[model samples]
Target: MAGIELRKVVKNFGKTQVIEGISQSVPDGTFLVIVGPSGCGKSTVLRLIAGLEEVTSGEIFIGERDVARLEPKDRDVAMVFQNYALYPHMSVRENICYGLKVRGLPKAEQERRLALAADMLGLSEYLDRSPRQLSGGQRQRVAMGRAIVREAAVFLFDEPLSNLDASLRNQMRVELRRLHERLGTTSIYVTHDQVEAMTLAQRIMVMNQGHVEQYGTPDELYLSPATVFTARFIGSPNMNMLRASLERGRLKLPGGTFLPPIPATDAAFTGRAGEILLGVRPEDLLPAGENAPETLRCRVELVEVLGADTLVHCALPNEAEGQEPIIARLEGSSRPGPGDVIHLGIRHGKAHLFDPVTKKRLAV
Candidate 1:
């Protein structure tokens, strides 16, 4: 196994750029995920690493070797694609060893690899069954089995679980994590699903419009997003962004709402007094308890009961007419119906501030 590196890598499709000067590194034996919405160049990055797509400029290295110009077969990396890409007539055992056979490897080595992969993938009993005879998840395992036999220096997965049903996808996520742990191989996985990225990645690189948005551990991205796009994109229910400004040495918000001034220790809000975006996650808005410091009056818009907690979507009192509804994740099953007025206390310390013009986080 080997670490991977991308230095100022760029990809262009004739006139338009798809991956723009992106650079990142994956340490040996680490699992890194490239994640974002569609057309974000995630899949393109995977292809570039797999040597399937040519870089218009820059370099890609697998350990000490620059593989930017190498053929896919020469990269010493195995890729499991979104589509199963299985040969329908081939039995599981045959499919698993096909790559090795094509490479003219000896029969003894091929059988040894095939047995190990089949057992690891729990396909031992189904090894003689054709691809058409297996289930979706089974076929995916076969695809992985094929990659495993190669014993490549690196593994690349391009939304490999995208075709599976929700339950099966969830199951596969666990299985994939276990497989990576046992192999300790440097792996690069690309997916649009944030949930998959959060659950499986050792580190995540969030991309947008050909640009690298942020790259860090899942907790780092979730707790301290580097930009508004990441703040909204990473978390469930999304973080709420509200218009804010400095007024009379206090923080002013839409709907004539006023809160305590930004902390004097927060240098980011100093020497700047214009439009900024205040970001607060749903879970940070708590139901008013005893002696709540800062509270907002809101009318419930909707409620989502999730057994352990209830998601209350509410709109602020008269002052916040046109703003998006605020969501609060409160403990227990106290469901509030539409039109019900509730007071929510703001956990201001947990909130974030971003520069509206740049849409970037303003560190305090």
Candidate 2:
């Protein structure tokens, strides 16, 4: 296993800068995921690390060695592409052992590695089958087995599960995690799926427009997002952002709703008393009891009944024209239909504050 580090890495195509000076470290044996939307340069970053693309500037280190200019073979890394790059003419055994043969390993050693990889991946029974005879998941396992036989120091996966169906993808995700635990190889997975990033990564680096937006553990990014972009991106159902004002330690929302006053000792509100952005997660907004203080009176516009839970989409009374309804995730038992008037309250200390101008979290 090897730790990987990038120091101000930059990549550009012609005059278009795709990677904007990204720098981060992946600890040895760590599962690090780079997640972002399309055109965010996530794949480019992975390719750069694989030595498929040269860096425009900066340095890359693997196991304390500078490999910025090294070829892919010399980088001591194994890559699993999205499409399983298996040879159609070869059986599973031949495909898995082909790399060893190219490197001129003894036949017995090649067999040993192939047996180990096949057993680890549960592909031992299909050794004689060609790629056409295997299911998508099994074929992917074959590709992974090919990489595993190399015993490379680092593993790079570029959206390796995107091609599978939903159920199969989930199954592969568990398999991948288990494989990592067994091999303890430093792995870098690139994907545009936030769900995959949250479940698989020890650390997640969120990128936007070719720049690093946030880098931290899943809990940190979910519970304490440092920027508005991250707050909106990392969560399912997306965080509901509202334009609001803060004055004299109190928060004022649209339609004249007022939240409880902020204590003077709270560092996040210290010296802040103007227009700000309020972020409330769907799960953090709940139905208020009768006569509850600090609640917003809204008219339900739609309701989605998900198993074990309900999503109430509501519009604030007297809200600005064309404003999107805020959704509250509630227990399935609480059924509120369209056109029903209800009051919702933010959970205690669950609200997130952001500077409207800078789009950054507000705190000391």
Candidate 3:
């Protein structure tokens, strides 16, 4: 197992800065996932670690050694790409053992490593099959097996499951977690999918517009996002943000409804009034009665029913023209339908307040 570190890492394409002043550490044997929307430079970060892309400035380190100038082969890290770049003509065994052979390992040693990898990945039953003969998930396992036999110091995965079907992706997620646990290798994973990031990583690094937005455990990013960008990006169905004001320790929403005072702390935005936002997770808000003092009456814009939960899209009265609507997840069954007038209550204490100017969470 190895710990990887990137210090002030920067990458550029011509005049465009793709990765900007990024720094983070991966603890030994820890699985670190870099996640963001497309074009957010998440894949660029993985490629930089894998030595596939040259850094414009800054350093990449493997364990205690600075490898900024090292070649991909010399970095002692294996990368599994989004596409399982398997050679169709090569047998599964050949694909897994190719690197070991090129490295001039003894016949017995290569065979041992190949055998162990195939067995672990349940590929022992298909050793002689070519890439064309295997399923997507099987091909992915071969790609993983190729990396496994390397016994590299670090592993870099670049959306390795993007090509699989939903069910296969889920299956591979479980398999990947088990493999990481068994090998205990330091791994850096990059993906745009938040589900993969939340399920696989010890900590998640959220990126946007070539900058690191927030770095934290999944729960930290979900429960206490560092910025508005993160609060809206990390959650499934997304969190709802409503414009509000703070006046004399009370929340003042649109239409002049005053809510109870939020907890006061240095983290809270004390004096901030206009240009403030109240953020609530979809799972936090609930339907309320008309007499509910803290409730905000919204017209149900849409409803999406999943097996265990239902999402209700709501529009606040006086919402800015052309502004994106808000969404709330109702636990279990939701009796409300489209065009229904519903009262949605802000989850007290659990809700977050942020400064619209700085986009920082108010400590309350």
Of the candidates shown, which would achieve the greatest TM-score relative to the real structure?
A: 2
Cα lDDT tens digits for candidate 3, 1-364: 6798889999999999999888888889989899999999999988888888899999998999888878899999998988988977899999998988889999999989988999999999999989899999999999999999999999989999999999999999999999999999999899999999999998899999999999999999988898999998998887888887777667787657776666654234455556578888888887888888877777888888886898888877754453346788887667578999888886767788788889988774
lDDT of 2 at 127: 99
Report the number of clashing residue pairs per model: 1, 0, 5
Task: Give one digit per residue, the lDDT tens place, for model 2 in 1-364.
Answer: 7999999999999999999998898899999999999999999999999999999999999998989999998999998999988999999999999888888999999999999999999999999999999999999999999999999999999999999999999999999999999999999999999999999999999999999999999999999899999999998888989888887678888677789865532666756688888899999998998599889778899999998999989987545764557989999999988999888998887888899999998762
**Alpha-carbon lDDT, every model:** 0.89, 0.91, 0.87
Off by over 4 Å in 1: 260-265, 289-293, 317-321
lDDT of 1 by residue, 106-193 (tens): 9999999998998999999999999999999999999999999999999999999999999999999999999999999899999999
Per-residue lDDT value at 19 in model 2: 97
Query: Is 1 or 2 the stronger prediction by TM-score?
Result: 2
TM-score quality measure for candidate 1: 0.95
Mind sharing the TM-score for model 2? 0.96
What TM-score would every model get versus the actual structure? 0.95, 0.96, 0.96
Question: In lDDT terms, how accurate is model 3?
Answer: 0.87
* lDDT, model 3, position 42: 92
Better of 2 and 3 by lDDT: 2
